[model samples]
Each structure stands twice: as C-alpha cells, then as structure tokens.
Target: MTTQTDLIQYLLRLGDSALIQGQRLCQWCGRAPALEEELALMNVGLDLVGQARNWLDYAAELLDDGRDADHLAFRRDERAYRNLLLVEQPNGDYAVTMLKQFFYDAWHLEVLQGLSRSSDERIAGIAAKAVKEATYHLRRSGEWVERLGDGTEESHQRMLDAIPLLWRFTIELISGDDSETRLHAAGLVPDAAQIASAWQARVEQVFTRATLPLPAAPSYFYLDARRGLHSEHLGTLLAEMQFLPRAYPDATW
Candidate 1:
C-alpha cells in the first residue's frame, strides 16, 4: 500500500518536472529562430505550466497543509523541489532544447497513457487530460527532430551531437522508487519497467524516422531529487521563477 507521504511526494515530483521544464521552455519565448517555431514553443510551455498547476494543486490537497499550488511552485527552496536533473539543465541551444523535449515528451506520453487507467480516479483524470496535450507535444518535437536531423549537413551534425548528450538523461524517467513499486502493486501507477519499454520503442521509431543514430547508454548519474537534491542550475531557475512571488509576497496582480 502506498502511504500518504509517498503519494504526496510522487505528486510533487510530477508537478516539479512540469513546472521546471515549462520555465525552461518559456526562456525561448520571442527568441525562437522562426515565428512559427516560437509560437509552438510558447504554446507547449503554457501547456506544461497548466499541467504543473493541476498536479501541484492536487499535491497541496494531499498534504492538507493550507498551502496552494503557487506556494509549492514559486515559494519552495531548491532542496524542496523534486524535479529530475534533466529538466533543470540549461537550455543550451535550439537543438539542445528540442532534443531534451523530444526525450522527455516520449517518456511522458507513455507514463501518462498508463496513468490514464490508474485505480486512483483523480490521477486517472489528470492523466487522461494530460495525455492529449502530451501527444501534441510529442508530435511537435518529433517534427523538429526530423527536420533538423535530415535537413542540412550542419543541421544533421548538430542533431547528432545532441542525441548522445540528451540520451544520458533519459534513464531516470522510467526509474522508480519504493513508492513507485507499491503504487504499481496497488494498480495506482504503471510499472516503470513496462513504461520504459514503450518509451524505448517510441524513441527508436522517432530516431529511425529522423535518421539519427541511437547512442549507447552511458554510466547513469543519479540525483536524488525526490529527497530534495537538485542540480546547480535549479538555483538560478528558482531565483528567476520566484523573484516576483518573493518580491510581492501575497499581493495579487
């Protein structure tokens, strides 16, 4: 059986991943190389932020501590965030950002698909709604991966370099903890191992279409974000994300 603490932690992890990745995506606002791509990135960022709000609000309800989504999102310290390291990595370039999104969106689609059938009704509902959005995200990122991978000699090279760099971070997406194991046993969550297979298949299909070679797996670097350990990039991200909230302190816009 999954404890309330475990559930709350799990929800927070979900929220944090979306929130931080949304923030990272938003950095590309008005800066994308093309107008269409700029709007696409912005739209996806908003979708992720919307998902983050729902998950964070649900997490607050589970905690029953009087805090709201905003508190858990913008007011939390770096060590309090449960997001994985990949989401917090600096958006190096367009290729880097798109590669990151491609990897994450593939994993997210599989996870959300499984969650859509969860025994927990609330989780199932959220997953059902989120999977639709995630599907669009995957499509958009996949399109870009193909364009960049098969375009020009320079574009293909950049995309190729991004593959190995981003692949290193892909392992943890389907890696689970004791809480995940219990949830799986209870039918409240999908088996991480199963989700990994789906993720792998999806990735392989996309890579084949893009004509990009898959990189061999590297030594896994585990960061215990569930226990509040985070990458250094998170501090800068938090400082910017929390600046307005910290300055305004309860004042509404």
Candidate 2:
C-alpha cells in the first residue's frame, strides 16, 4: 500500500533527525566541559552527519527533482523538516545534553537494527554501517548518563531536573505515524510496535542503572514532527545552517 512518495518521506524523517541532532552536538564543540569530551562529541556529530548524507542521498535520488542531499538538507524551510522533536530542542546543560543524546541514541539504535534487514538493499547497507556508529554513540551516552546521574549531589540533581524537560518529547520515539506503518506492512521497514518495545526496554534498563526515575508516561506538546511540525528552535537552527547555501545558491562547493 505504500508508494515511493511514502518511502521518500520516511527517508526524510531519518535523514532530518540525524542532520539536526548532529548540528546540536556540533554546537558543543567549543563549550564541552573537557577537551576529551569535546572531541568525542564532535566525532559523534560527524558520524551522524555522514549518516544523514547517506539517507538524504537516497531520498534525493528517489525524488528525481534535481535536488541533491545538500539541497534537501540546506534548502528546506522549518515546516518541511521531518526530524524528531527531541533533536530540535536546544542543548541545555551537560546533563541535559547527555540525557537527550541517550534517549535519542537508544531509539536510533533500535530503528537501525531493524532497518539492517530492510527489503531495500541500499537501506540495509546504510543501516548496517550506521549500526556500528550508533552502537558506540549509545554506549558513550549511556555511560555519561550513569556518571552524571550517580556522581555528585549537584550532578545528580541536574540529571533529575533534565528528566522532566526532556521526557515529554520522547513520546515520538516509540510511536510511528501512517507512513511508517505502511512501510512496515510491506516489509520495507521494522514494525513500529517492536521498535517501541525494544526502545522502551533499553531506556528502562539504562535508567535503572543510572538510578534515574522514569517518567510515568510519555507526553507531547501541541506539535508532531512527523507531520512536518517542529519546535521553534528548529527554525533558528535552519536559519543558521541554511544561510550560506541560500545566500549563494549558485555557488559551488
């Protein structure tokens, strides 16, 4: 029942989330708490950007509308973005950053693990390569969550404070819209319910170790990113990210 248009939109969701999340991580390059941590964050950001390019490349090809990956990433307005709401949120304190990354990394790994078996070979190949990087990302972020959550009183309190701010956005992580359902039914993507179950289990396991309390339930604000709705932060982010390309549309890199 799914058409190529559905597939293109689904790919955009994956590509956009990686692109925005990578940009958020890069914002910490000069401000990370330590040099070593800064380098790690940059490396992770680059990995996500690379993955974004791969997904966007395929999406561009499917569209056949003369736009390349760069165009799709840099030319789109905020309302056209399909990234998850969690990634668009501003990077708060280090604790908030780590928790946000942990939440996303957890869901990302589940989705990529399922996509590794995608009916489309290109998708499967991309997912297979991304799985290695995502596995490392999740492990690194999960460790940070534990270190800060269980470390000192101040760090522990910060982690606790971050939970409520970031938890609500997590509703999007386990839930999929109609496009995803169509793909899954066609065996082109993973089952949404299965992805949700795995993501939730991983989150619960990590939270238990960090001694962090899990939100009783996930909630969302008025917007849904899957439907081309996004947080206000995304508009600011896109303005900065897209400035050069828009200003010099004819310029070649």
Candidate 3:
C-alpha cells in the first residue's frame, strides 16, 4: 500500500479505538462506584473523545472524500471500523472496567509516546498533545488496578475473574499488521516490538503491585478488528451511537 493509505488506516485505528472506548467509559456516568470516580471517568472519556476527534479529523483530511470527522465517526458501518478488539468489548463490573482501562491505557501511552516523535509533523503534534492525556489515564487506571487487586478478597477475585475474560484479546494490542509495518518503515510510527515490550513491562509492573498474576499470552481470536472484524457488541454500540445522525441526517448542531 502507499504511505498515504497506510497512514490513513493507522489514524482510523487510533481514532476508532478512542471513540469506542470513550463511549464505553461514558456508559459509567451514573453507574460508577462513587461520585468522584464518576466525574473522573467522564473526564477521561471526554479526553479520549477529544483525542479521537484529532485523529479522525486528520484521517478525514487525508482521505478528502467529502467526509468530515463527524461523518467518518458516525456514518461508518461496523465493518468499516478499525478499532482494537480490546476496546470494543463490553465493560462488565468495576473491576472489569478498570482492568480493561488499564490494559488499553498501557498500550495507548506507549503508542502515543512513540508517535510523539514521528517524522510526520502532523502526527507528532497530535501525539504530543494526546500523550499527556494518556499518561494520566495510565496512572489512574494502574492505581485502580492496584487498589482493587490488593483490596478485599471479593474485589481481588473480581479482578482475577476479569483476567481471563480480557487477556486473550491483548494479543492484538502488540501485534502489528502490514499497514503498521509500512508506517514504521516510513518513520511515521514507532517500532511495534518496542511498543509491545514497553506495554508488557507496564502491565507487569501494575499487576505485580496489584498482586494479580499475569496470564500467558493467548493466540489471536478468529476475528480481528484491525481488519474490520469485530465482536457482535460493536453493532449494538453503533446502533445507539449512530441513531441521532442516521435519524436526522440534515439536522445541524
């Protein structure tokens, strides 16, 4: 593929994951365990949504197919989404939510940090801005993981239960495909191995503090989100998220 195509795909991967994950976090607006936590979650979700706009905006600019960021975000079918499988999974209990957040934050920070130094000025600028938000996200999620994992037996076990449910999808977190390889070659993105290594180290450090055992890395699932194959949950999510735009195609905000 051309460098332009690769970059667009990479941006969509970044943007779609942030959009979906942000939407998932917003689901906790009224349901978070505490008031302060609810506010924090919402703020983080907003941060991610803002980051998604930055990415999708750039992707739309490059595509230049008459679709703006809103159209790219809301008008796409599930088969067109390039988000990571980990981000699209349904949020379960608090433990499940935090652990999932921690995992994604870990990888997200690494990828953002790497992109912050991109040879492409636009990508570097966007990543520079995003890295700050991702850093706080990782720290907050990491602390939560430690708190719940080392807390009461029930909370700890909930984290344990969360492991098997989320762990398998993590393979996609570190696994880079051809588009990423092309970007890496062009210095538009970071080395996938380095990002994977850093991601694993962060996960290990947080899990060690949380007193949770890290499981063996599992094989990729039959479906891959980077290739537009997502879990069934994505369709349900898109229905809710896209309803407004689809229903009012000519309405202006």
Candidate 4:
C-alpha cells in the first residue's frame, strides 16, 4: 500500500477476512444440507485459507517482525483483528450463509479487480491469483441465493428474513475510512465509494435474478469495522482459534 503501516493493516484486513470466512465455512462441513454442498463449502474454505496464508505471509515480511502467518492468525486477540464485520458475523441458516457469502464474494471480486491493476507488483500478483477463486465463489453463492430465494416457500422466506440483518454490515465494506482514502489516492486500493457502485450493481443484478427485493436505503448503524472494531462474536471466535497457539507457544504441526 502507501506505507508500511498502511500495507500491513490492509493485508491484515484482507487476510483476516479470508481466515475468518474460511473457518466459518468449515463449520458447515458436517452440517450442510447436502453432501455436495458439504464438499463445496469445505473446498471453498480451503481456498480462503490459502489466500489468507499468501496475504499474511507477505504482511509478516513487511513487518520484519518475528511473527509469521500462524502467529498473526492465532496469537492475536480479537481486538487486534481487522477483518470486515460481514465476514465475522455468525452464519445462521443455509440461506443466511449463502447470502452473506454472495455479498462478500461480490465485494471480494471488486477489490481484487482493482488490486490486480495496482502499481505494487506483489499485491497485483496476489490479486490476480485471487480473482479466479473469488469468481468461483461469487458464482457459487450467487446461484445459491437465486435458487433459495426463488425455490420453495420456506427457502424464499429464509432468504428474505436473512437479508436485512446482514445488509447493514455490507455498508462498511464499501465505506472505507481515512486510511483507505490515503491508500486509494496512492493507487494502493480502489475507492470504496466507486467500488460501492460496482458492488451495488452486481448485488442488484443478483437480487433481481433471485426475485429478492433490494433495500431502498439501508442504514449503516454498525461499528466501524475497518479499524479493528468488531462485534462480540469475534471474542468467542478468537478464544477458540487462538487457544492452541496461546496454550502451546511456538508449537508446530
């Protein structure tokens, strides 16, 4: 990004989102509605984790700190995390999870599209690789949202009910703060406001295809998640994800 601090934080935000989403997806491995879905979720989870490693390792290199990807992923407390609120939210039902995935995948693809053209060659390369995986994610989630929203009575209602609650957090994804503003000006990242337009267009297209109504003007009353602010759920999630690392310091697989 613009500076060491900016790049570090940006990478943390990127890597953390992928790590948390990967873990959340894994939670559905045994619980998905069907065997195919179960396998699909796990595969996507692995993809996210791989992305996390690439981002975090490069972040650690920038830091020149003793920390590695595992340390950043496991040793840090909840408050130290910079993942988006959309990702850290608990996955409710299948429809809820799919809608959340669709939202994130849409945003992820846009972010990668911008980053793929970045002046920073490393970031651009990573974004190039990630774009392929993210495209698959958006396709998978988008199809599921359409299917569930237009499917039988119960599935449609589930999607309808899940949208509003999760919709609030999507705003933060597109409303980057001062840090992002600086980075955007330096050509390190895309302007979220501009990216927001692209994100909205994609979301609207998917929603229309799904027969789901779009929120006319959804309010963003949630915390400023870009700067490490998080919901209560992150604490519990970190407690488990960090337990082994904290308990057995310097442990290796």
Candidate number achieving the greatest lDDT relative to the actual structure: 3
The better candidate by lDDT, 1 or 4, is 4
Q: Residues 1-253, candidate 2, lDDT per residue (tens digit)?
A: 3479899988999999999999999999889999999999999999999999999999999999999999999998888899999999999999999999999999999999999999999999999999999999999999999999889999999999999888989999888878888898777899988988998998889888889888786865789987888877999999888999999999986
Indicate whether candidate 1 or candidate 2 has the larger lDDT: 2
TM-score of 4: 0.96
TM per candidate comes to: 0.96, 0.98, 0.99, 0.96
Evaluated against the true structure, the overall lDDT of model 1 is 0.86
lDDT of 1 at 221: 73
- Top-TM-score candidate index: 3
| CA shift of 171, model 1, Å | 1.7
Q: What is the lDDT of residue 138 in candidate 1?
A: 94
Q: Write the per-residue lDDT of candidate 4 for residues 1-253, one digit (tens) a residue.
A: 4477887899999999999999999989779999999999999999999999999999999989799998899988887899989888899999999999999999999999999988889999999999999999999999999999999999999999999879988887667777878888888888879888888999999899889999975566747666568998888888877888899996779
Candidate 1 Cα outliers beyond 4 Å, as residue runs: none
TM-score, candidate number 1:
0.96
Query: Which structure is stronger by lDDT: 2 or 4?
Result: 2
Q: Of the pair 2 and 4, which is ahead by TM-score?
A: 2
